[model samples]
Target: MKKIGKTLKSACVLGLSGALLVCSVGCSSSSESSGGEKTGKKQLVFWDKSEYVTAYNDMMKEKVDEFAEKYDVDVDYVIVNSGDLEQKLAAAIESGNQPDIIMGDNTSVAEYIASDQLAEVSDVLADIDLKEEAKPYAVFNDTEYLVPLSLTAPGMFARQDVWEEHGLEAPKTWEELKEQAKIINDPDNGFYALGLPLGESGGGDAETFIRTIILDYGGEVVNAEGEVTVNSPEVLEAFKFIASLYEEGLVPPDATTWDDSGNNSAYTAGTVGVVFNSGSLMGTLKDEYPEIWDNTAIFDYPAAEEGGQSYTLGGANVFGIFKTGDNTETAKEFISYFFSDTDFYNEMVEAIGGMWQPVINGYDDTEFWQDPDNAVWLTAASNLTLTTAPAPTTDTAAQGFSNHLCTKALQNIVVNGMDPQEALDGLEADLNELYQ
Candidate 1:
């Protein structure tokens, strides 16, 4: 509850400042305006995240250069750190200094739509082969806005060698998962069975994990009709289950304070037997620890009950056009061209590596996606399901995520020793107020 209090205070401060105070820090913008202005070329501003991934940045530069050459546009390409994107975007929106085209986490797109800062791209989507299931975060009020670039399904991963040493198979049911975790729990040697990031400081991973369990149990924070349902019986079961993981000594004590990278570091350090994370963990294991990489295995999140459906929290990154920008047509054309060019898109996907999986309909047939090493994760991505959030409902879900609602509720139980029902009741109250 203390952590939640701090989060609410921080959010309030940010809101008062219009969430733009951090926009100037580490801000860098580059322009290819040179002689293009003299030639009457249109000026297009493009912003993307991931400033540290050299390969991704290089690929983006190459693509932007090609776009400029083909379309006669002066592109101002800005690379913002992903963590800083929300604030930077908020500042840009507040000041009316919007980029023509921007790529961001799918959640941010929902927030932008809530604020009416995005330009509609229904005409662009009509020309493309956008899949129905893939349209959840990209559409609002029956009009398309986001061009989903790629997605990731964060599923469960385990150290195969450890499981083999313990003579255990990957758990298919939540009960079996817990039983196996209890068997593997050995904190005396600095090891734990589960790498659950329950801390609100862990960023969205905790919320995603909690929501995945809730969805698996046939519960949701908000139903299709947009009513707050956090206190449903299924959600209570999910909450008590999460608390049991900690109370039974399966999760490490430090999980209460670990940030977004906590579980990743814990698993990499050989301190955890199983971790629920994105496919990127496979990439890390492959690059930094080949021994573990060879023995690593992935599986879908264990089912909530023996016969229940399995679900993994999923999301995507999207390309969007700003309503305030004057280059809407140019932005739409570039998005269309990027998606339609199969070769270029595949090359970009390769460059992106585990950061995102292909979102297009036919990419499952691509050689890159068919590799044996990617089997587990590819299956996970293909089966990913998302919570429905339409129009006004979408805005509430985005705010819930941004506010770390579920994570806070889990912390209230695990850290503050509050009753699971009470924590859930508080969560329901908060959400009802938010969704209202």
Candidate 2:
């Protein structure tokens, strides 16, 4: 694993946009005195991202309760939606009331680390044995701020019955996908070939899709030294190719306006032949729409060209300790306890339908990962390209991803009909501004 450290050119300044609305789940406030004083017991505030699987949240609540009893601490566990976490966290930081621990995606961690609000937890990571692929994403500037909890990646979900009816097989490359999409697209029958989102809303589904394409086409947002390199010919080609998908009507027309759940909703509704998302969609299908789940087949992301290298964007879902509050040690202890029971952790992952891949080395060899229906997720986790690849995982790149710059550029071309070069130029300027 490579350890990278760099002085970020700029600090990310988060604007306080709205009031923080936190939803508490299985919370206990009895330990606090009327005046908000701790009643001779340590209090730990934890914010967990709401999972798509309700059982995962429920299991975590049970674990938090157990930890509180085991460690003699009062815990206030809040479940925050992934889309609202950044804003709520920003509010908490600005008000000097941040939680002791937060669980979120890598982009949020990088943004917070850049703002100097996260505490280095390298000591906490030392006790856990992590997989080789999970190690690189945990370190920044030779310091660790996030403890990885699980892995997630976007996989191509195709309608097997639809493909079979057309005598087609799952596509293995971008050209094949487009060709198959053209043949199977039946807009008259209310089925589009693909459900690629280009919208700027939600937590960067559009950005993830576009960035994977940019890298697969040999483009880089930045070089290894963290220099801006997005305005090159390769990037321009990538932009044109993506815009061509919308232009040729291969993707849903409203994909430009979709939020994070747009593709999931479309896939569930059987309006699109294929969609790219994590296993959360698969879990949803199995539980709510088993008929559709029965026909859905997951595949690795298609390569940019025939016989070319393929890439998918993903990273570990991590736990970040905040520098705020006096409960840093308490938070670390709870994290250790959370992963202490290897059996329970493995069971929880299986219960969640393997939507959350294991970050520990030996956890992946279990029967759950070997199941054919669940193996694609394991394959994706094994070969993840962190959101900020090519460039070191720096605050600047993280902020760019959080801002959805790539998606915005694609929207400018596909939605507004701006020239691809012009959009790429604007994207370069915006990214350079962030890096500067």
User: For residue 285, what is the lDDT in candidate 2?
Assistant: 94
Candidate 1 matches the true fold with a TM-score of 0.88
lDDT of candidate 2 at residue 174, scale 0 to 100: 82
Tens digits of per-residue lDDT for model 2, 1-436? 1222222222211212221212122133332342136566777999999988888889989999999998889899999998789889889888888999999887777688887878898888888888887887787655888898888877889999999999998788887888899999988888999999888876777888888989988899888889999999988988898898899998889898999899999999999989989888988999999999999888668888877889888767899998776689999999999888878888887888978888887777788889988887888888988877888877777888889998998899998999999998899899989988
CA RMSD (A), model 1: 11.6
Give the true-structure RMSD of model 2: 12.9
Error of 1 at 402 (Å): 1.9
How much lDDT does candidate 1 score?
Answer: 0.78
* TM-score of each model, paired residue for residue: 0.88, 0.90
